[model samples]
Target: MSGWQRVLRGMLDILYPPPPLCALCERPLRHFLQGRGAVEEPSLLCVACEKQFAFIAGEICHVCGRPWIGESCGDCLRRKERDFLFSRSAVRYNDKMKELLARYKYRGDRKLAEVMAFFLQQAWRLHYAEMKVDCLTYIPLHEARLFERTFNQAEEMACLLGKRVGVPVYGMLERRKATEKQSKKDRAGRLHALENVFSYAPCGKYDLPERPVIVLVDDVYTTGTTVAEAGRAIRTGISGAQIYGLTVAR
Candidate 1:
């Protein structure tokens, strides 16, 4: 940010502050950190709330990468025979997590996206670090939705992660069809609705690197239809590309 822009934002922050302190913590961080120490890093959660929600654990499906109660979610154990069946998300879409995602995505809180990306990076390091990924791409927003929202939250998260992980972020997947919200639909309904909705194209004019892999990013993964369709496009439209997905919500 430029100097003037920073000054303006700072002024606005004081005038109309973003929710003071962490959303979960009712206590103000100014009070928490008072005389405790000088800070060298950026953090709002006085270490305890930060550490409590630090990581998402327990058994997760190898294919869909969702936290499961039993051995595996039905989608993971049975992916209906596809080239790219594996998928993963950083956190589950519980009530609290959903509120955070809404704040970042709809309320234009980019900093919240950055904090959420921290969890995403942790999930990647724990589960997907061994995968030789070539690039990161976000599940693209439709042109209409892109205009309506004025930003793509998934792409925002991807750019943050790409900066830290030392990988290129590409907007390769295109949304050819617009559909209703998946959150309100059943799994079969979602899978059928998006069958002809997405397509994959070349990342750019340059020839993609050899044995290049692609990681798809999205805000949420409920029914797995969106990413599955996008992955199929990558497998068919492009060659020699391994596809994966990273989502904030599962």
Candidate 2:
């Protein structure tokens, strides 16, 4: 943030202070209430709530980003083809993460988008900081689903991440048709159902980068079927593009 932005933020804080209670646990933040230390950005989570995150670290699969002893996980090893170059996730899809995502995606708790985007930013820094990311795009929701949900969680996180990372966010693909929820299906079922569901449909206003390195953003990475199909659609539009998947959880 710039100096003037900081000044403006401070002014805003004085007029409208952040909530004293943690967003999840609703415990009062002693530090904020006491006003003892220099405040950073208004925190949505308490230290305890933050500790619940199971961040992905240490050795991981080169292809899938799953915690593994070997370079590649068995699933990736057995896969005949993958559209995207590779994929990385910020955290494990544990019980806490599941609940958090449910609140955001299902309950329409938009405030949690910041928390999800923060993890995506961290994942980018940890894994793709050195890479040349031309732009960021997201797995698009179908029109019907988008209307029903009011907003796309993946798109929200991608936009927030784009602002923080100085990368442009684009709508490079769209769902051709809506299918049944992937959660109900097994890996093979998901793969078969998602086939040819995504289609490249870049926005007319923005110019496409030549042979770009595109990062596909999403809330979760399960069987890798979703992003793989989306990447394939992107390839159909931009043949030379190198695609990578980044999700909040795997």
Candidate 3:
């Protein structure tokens, strides 16, 4: 951001202060500001609400990153082939996370994108800190769905995470067609529906490195079908590409 941009943002902040209540529970926060003359950082969730989040920890599946006692999850074990190198997520998709995602994704509560991006950042630090990441891309929405939603939640969160990690984000993949919502589908149905749904279409402005390492960002990883198909599309376009998946929830 430029100096004038900062000045403009400060002016706007003073003119229109943020709400005093938490986003989730609407509880009043005790310390909402960083300090005097600093930007007021509104808390997304209160202490009690934050405690309800289930961060993924302990042993996890090597391929799918799901919390598991064994080396690989049942989903991975049953699968014959995998496209992405691996996948990892920050939190378990519990009731609290599902509610939060619904508000952010379907209800257009965009402020929650920051919180979701923070979760992605934490997942990156934990899982991909040492990995070579040439660029970050997101699971793109079809134009129809994008128009309906007014924004791609995955793209928004990916941009925020890229800024924090100092990586360049690009629209390297495109959704070929709109399909039925994956949430309602079984794993086999999801995989079948997602076939040929994605195609590689890199941004023209930037040239990706040879044999690039790309991370696919999304809001959630349920059956892993979405990211897997996306990875396959990318591989078709860029041979020897190393693809990985990073999502807010699993």
Report the number of the highest-lDDT candidate: 2
lDDT per residue for candidate 2 within 13-110, as digits (tens), equals 89989658776788976553221123234545677886798888888999989899988998899888989999999889999999999999989999
Give me the candidate number with maximum TM-score. Answer: 2
lDDT of each: 0.73, 0.87, 0.86
Poorest 10 consecutive residues by lDDT, candidate 3: 33-42
lDDT of 2 at 163: 96
Model 1 lDDT, full chain set: 0.73
Model 2 misplaced regions, further than 4 Å = 1-23, 26-44
Query: What would the TM-scores of all predictions be?
Result: 0.77, 0.85, 0.84
Residue 193 miss distance in model 1 (angstroms): 1.5
- Expressed as tens digits, the lDDT of each residue in 147-219 for candidate 1 is 8789988888899989877878877778887787877878788888888687876668544676568888888
Which sections of candidate 1 miss by over 4 Å? 1-44, 51-54, 69-71
| Model 2 poorest 10 in a row by lDDT | 32-41
Clash-forming residue pairs, model 3: none
The number of clashing residue pairs in each candidate reads: 0, 0, 0
Greater lDDT among 2 and 3 belongs to 2
Q: What's model 1's lDDT at 69?
A: 75
Q: Once model 3 is optimally superposed onto the true structure by TM-score, how far is the C-alpha of residue 19 displaced, in angstroms?
A: 13
